[model samples]
Target: MTSNMKTQVDDQMVLLSQYYPGIYDQLIPEQGEVVKPRRRRKKNKADGNSSMMRKRKLSDEQVNLLEQNFGNEHKLESERKDRLASELGLDPRQVAVWFQNRRARWKSKKLEEEYSKLKSQHDSTVLEKCQLESEILKLKEQLSEAEKQINSLVERSDGISSTSPCSSFSMEAMEPHFLGGFGMEGLENVFCLPENNYIHGSLDWMNI
Candidate 1:
């Protein structure tokens, strides 16, 4: 082969060697300074392959725009996927996967919000219950105090009623002594008189 042909062949071999490391290395002619084959880049199956095994990824901008335009709560992920697929020039499967992931994320966020609201409600209910319990306890104490006061008053009334008639009799006996001190000696002597005489004397004294 001419020098130009040989050079062209060598260039092709180098290109091939870069693509297939072990296979091309053995077949290619060793010349000036064997070019070490670059380490083959690992092919990302998701990006490079057209197979169904690949997981779909969505751009943040696209996802955010979708959520803004069509609410994250849009039901029917399949329908949303079809619509987004038409807009973004992506496969329906990819859109479907994206929607599935987005829905899961949205659901988790919504559940967290609901949990917070319920927790707040529960806390408020507990506080109200405690306040009500305190009010009930206060009422019970007031009722107990009122009952005690009523009992005390009843006992005092019983004592006073039972002793009042006796007290009035003793007062009548002492009244004559008070009148005698005021030059009512006859009124004092009337108390020592017979019962019938005393009644008549008391009646006369009352009339005067």
Candidate 2:
């Protein structure tokens, strides 16, 4: 490089050093040793191979034996786990994990059964309540019809009395067919009350 260009470069570096003192030492150290950024170590072959390892499928005979042992004891003792692992030619951890998985499946199944039973009972109770409500609504509709009949009877009786001063009410005309359960004697007594007393008195029968 030319002398003038080198002088200009040195002057620019000096100005940068004034503004950032630490950056100048990294770019141009006093002893002239170059600084290299530390590199991260790559993963070992063992770690890479461990991730690629495939799961081994258990033999039919091994599965059957495990099922038999699980049925007898849902939770195995440590010694029993080691004994089964030895017999099956497998690790103790594998035997223990199998039992854990089996227990989890069993617990889930039991919870589902319990939930199904409770849901069935709740549905039945709701249906029974709906049926009872429907019955009550029907009875109310029947009672309304009966009230209209009673009002008609009272009007007919009142008209007859006004027309003939000496005439007595007909026994068959005054008898309410819908209220046959109530004795004719009790019904006749209420109607026998003179004047407008009978109209208000008839309301007593509906109190039941």
Q: Pick the candidate with the highest TM-score.
A: 2
Which segments of model 1 are wrong by more than 4 Å?
A: 1-57, 76-80, 162-208
Give all candidates' CA lDDT scores.
Answer: 0.62, 0.69
Model 2: residue 174 alpha-carbon error in angstroms: 24
Worst 10 residues of 1 by lDDT: 199-208
TM-score of 2: 0.47
Summed backbone clashes in each candidate are 0, 0
lDDT of 2 by residue, 35-139 (tens): 543333434555646644344667888889999999998999999999999999989999999999889999999999999999999999999999977876665
**TM-scores for candidates 1 onward, in order:** 0.46, 0.47
* Model 1 lDDT per residue over 1-208, tens place: 9999999898777665676656655766557656555545645766766766464556787767667645745554677668777887778886666656777987899999999999999999999999977875664455455545545655676678966543333324544664455433543323343345432321343333
